[model samples]
Target chain A: MKKALAMLLLVLVGTLLFMGIYAMEGFRPYGEVDLAQRVSQAYIDKDVTGENPEVVYGISKDLETGSANLVTSIIVNYRSFDTLGEVTVLFLSALGVSILFGSFKGRLRSRYQPNFILRTGSKVVFPLILIMGVYIFIHGHLSPGGGFPGGSMIASAILLMYLADEAFRIRIEGFKMTEGIAGSLYVLLGLVGLTLAGYFLSNFLNTGTVGALFSAGIIPVVYVLVGLKVGSELTGIITDFLKGEVE
Target chain B: MINPVLLIAIPLLLAFVSILYKGYRNNLLVFGALVNAGLVLTLGKGEYLIGGFKPPFGINLVLDDYAFLGLLVINGLFLLITLMSLDKIGENATVLLVALAGLNGLLLTGDLFNLFVFLEITAITAYILSASSRQYQHSFNYLVLGTLGSGLYLFGLILLYAVFGSLNMADLSLKMATADTSQLVIPSLLIFIGLGVEVKILPFNGWVRGVYGNSDSLVGPLFSAVYAGAMLLVFGRIFAQVIPLGAYLKTLLLLLGALTLIAGELAALSKTRIREILLYSSIGQSGLIVTLFLSGLVFPAVMQLFNNILSKAVLFTVAGQMADTTGTDDAEALQGAFARHKLAGVAFTIAGLSLIGMPLFYGFVSKINLLFGVFSLDNYWLPGVILLGTVIEGTYLIRLLVKLWMPGEEGLVSHESHATKAPLEIQRARVMGIVVLSAVLLVGGLMPGMIQNNLSESGRLLDETTPVYLFDLKGGQ
Candidate 1:
């Protein structure tokens, strides 16, 4: 009876809400007179020309931030404040998982260790994967991949080791310290931008010539910090998940 | 003229550093909080363009009058809670600091997406902090509900961005004026639901009880007083500035607020546990604040919010102590607790009187203001409902007081005999914290005029700080 009543009420409210929404202007069938398309039309034009008065000196994001990847430029330089918060959210999630699962204190291991081939393959492939992760973040401003994807890549490598070696134990404290330092530096760099220029997280350093590896002022630097911080935090989370029980 | 970003950046820096220096996490947090409080005090009002980017292109932070008042209340409550919970908080100190950073961002950020990001920061850390209790499931519930609400909020932002083509509040306000009103309906509802979740709007707030009931004594009040205050202020800003409200929207909010108040009061009356009663009362008070807010009475809404914060801080802290001493939160178990813990009883009585809106209490002034606001609208039904809720509120609180002092369980009723009936000792520090809060409540009530000028100024500032006015100011700078 209760379930039926709830369903009935839900349907009623949903219908009323939809009816109300239909009464508003500008909402039309998809692909018909797309009003939303015009909203970002100016931005798209700026993205193409690489010049918009919305930024400093009418310099394009490519010239100002020097990041080839528009998304990377957006995430790290133009709207870095949101990225700061996004990083904290990921860090907090890791912390919460660890708090609930406790630090892995050499607890119960896998029931069956991977065969010899799997173990040997993971060990040999680990450093190569780590280097790839580092490369991604280092080239975040000039390439497709950035901090979050790169960090997850490194964490995946660590997860491979956890699967291969049943007795391998990570020193949770060391990982924690790395995460903390990297997170702190991200903020410190933003503060540096604040003191050097008038704005917080402003590109205080020179926006080197476009397409250069060392370009984009603090964009690449912040991305690298985020990459390292996210990598270690994710590793900590995986280790906690694999560990059996919390004390 | 301190940079408002430092309000967020400094504590985050200290919190991160404290991880490497665990032994000093508590002291580091305390020091950082004091610095934050100092910065907020000296901070001048302005719009801070982040990354040297202009509005409509980059995120900005604002420190207008409403935000300044929010900062003071948030920082003041955080300092008190940190001092009171230093010994009991354990590893949660870092989490608390991070949550404070999130709250600061929530109050100051000027963009819609940035607001969403800060909302996640606050929710994630609060989930961890609230999960410290044995009821871990409650934290999981909080995570699910909070995430769902934020998801809806993000969807709304996407819709607004699609139609209006901007994420900055000022920019959006400029475009939204001519945008399709039909396209905005879904987004506005989504955002309202998202922000309302934090303020404990009814029907959508299933996780409230589990969170408030399970969090440690200090954290419960922190969530209620500081966290809720920030969220409420943000909600008010959105309605007053970002989205111009239609009559239909206002009426919808008013009805929801009335329902929430009645439901909360009835739930409080039904609950046997003392902490649960206080939790429901907290919800009811928030409901009252929301109702006044939706009525377009910004001043009285803020005043009521202040009263709720001060009184809840005292009530929740004392209830935590009482529960600790009695070993159970059942009202029957707390009979004669006044004899054993005189200080707690005194603090509870003062806070209770304030919550009941007795004359000479801040609650009384705020309540009268709210009534006037409602009466001016010629809305007899709302005033009638409010009076009914208040009557219901008075009956339960008075009943609790009787149970508290009327000795030996004579009028007290218990479903089961509590095992740990012996009164445990109370901590001097917690008692001291409650005494300080009580004094603030008394002083605020006795000298209401001291804040009248500032309150009216902030109330006027609330509407004047709209996006259009702010956008004009931005050009001069």
Candidate 2:
């Protein structure tokens, strides 16, 4: 029966691939597809809500979405609700980790004592990594990196601290507080848009020049909240994992 | 007018607040559920856009009658379940808050990929809720299947977006209406298999046995009723309304639903444990509803889904409570177990009888409409199989009800003294909640018009066939 099922699945897949490749007009070959015909063109040109056929970096003023990075403009500006949902997804995952390990005791202790160099190095490196993470999220609307990568980087820094110094315990309550406050402020910001403007997550701020540091309306602010929330959430998960369960 | 987006946002907001004020998480959960339930009632039928952008460009919440009906029932039940078992929500209040948001999003989102996002959020919370049993293996099993299911859903959705260059459901439907549906075979099938896992179609439901069987009272009703109902409603929304399918693929999926119905009933007939029987029954009902939707009987399909989830909520709660208290759910071990808890027994009996499609119950109304709808399709064989499945369903459910109500030696004189000594007690709050639900079933059963009116509301919005009342209706033709 299992063999027959496997055969059935194989036949099905093969048939689909053939049909998708040959008979499907909608499935045009990749490069032949016109980006101008896609909705993404509007995202790239920042012409979704209004006609800004051209979005020149550091030139266009008071355009629809001022995020210079097209991806950030789409993810954080055009469809910010989906991004909020994505943030909640990561938050829920980290929350799941904490709940499952809720019964655990203090941090997991290592057998081998780390050398002075490794411990000292993680401490010396931690501040720099933190700053880099902050920079990435702060410049998310202008550059490639955003909340998710930046937050994970911050968590990685905390992981380094754990590895190097066993007794170095960052208080988990502080991280939880950070996670909660960041997440709540994110939603509150969206609500503020809903109240002042007519839409949730509306770009209610003065969206200045595209490439400027303080532009992109609510995009940078959202990314900053997302970064803090993700950073604290991942840190909370790490803390829960490290804290061994007690009977 | 209430913005439908608030239904998805407030719970999320409260959930975020919950993590900060951990001490007040349960209070926040109740408040969120209350706020959601209250908000949904005031919401009118319209498309509410997010980010202040037009449809086909930005995300929107479609609060048509179908979505409104879903929001009404799902939010109502979420509120009840939270109130019913607030004590059981220890350490998981944040998860419930997020789940409420996710379930609302699943029902309301007009964008397909946005639906996938909600599906993931809801699925992850389900995994966390399942783990509340401390049966990590079962939760892990559920986690793997659910993740795979959502991934496939996303894959299918991405394909659709790539093909049409849009993610809006209405726009995609319009696009697919013009395009050759034959080309859509793979994406539609991929979507079917993806949603099939959560909808509990026969082959894709390996996690049901472990997850549902191990879940306690709080998690059981929420999963079986709220989550299951929302997913089935979404299935109807997508398959029956959105994605136009070719004749061949349509027939193929119809046959799959038929197969699931029969197989689910047969499997349920063989189960001795309470929750397992109900889980299989839930699958069977899902299949029956899926078949109805695919057959183009949207009204009956949604109504049948309503009946199934409503009854399953009561059934699973009692069954889960039994296992929680007695540490076992074996039917023989729980014989006459409901003797002491008469109110719970009555609720269980009403739910069971309704599930068996007994008259003057909501299930009977749905069953009649379903049979009428199927017969209207001139599909004789499926109705016969449905009848046979109903017989098997009735036999097992009645047998189980008898065992729970009357305990004695096999063919000898029955006595209350013969009841099992297993001490079990339903909480006052849970009993009240189930009583309220059962009363709704009874009321819905007696006044079929009340339910039909709501069905017609959506049918009119959908521009589909109007729901048929008891004997015949204006739209039966």
Tens digits of lDDT, candidate 2, B167-241: 888878877888988778878988998999999987789999889988889999999999999999999888887
Best by TM-score: 2
Candidate 2: tens digits of C-alpha lDDT, residues A31-87:
887877668777777777776757777888998888889899889987899999999
Clash pairs of candidate 1?
A24-B182, A25-B182, A50-A60
Estimate every model's Cα lDDT from 0 to 1.
0.79, 0.87
Instruction: Give a tens-digit lDDT track for model 1, residues B445-464.
Output: 89888777655444323235
TM-score for every candidate vs. truth? 0.91, 0.95
| lDDT of model 2 at position B14 | 97
Q: Write the residue-wise lDDT of candidate 1 on A131-180 in tens digits.
A: 99999999998889989999999999999988988767788799899999
Q: Model 2 Cα displacement at B106 (Å)?
A: 0.5
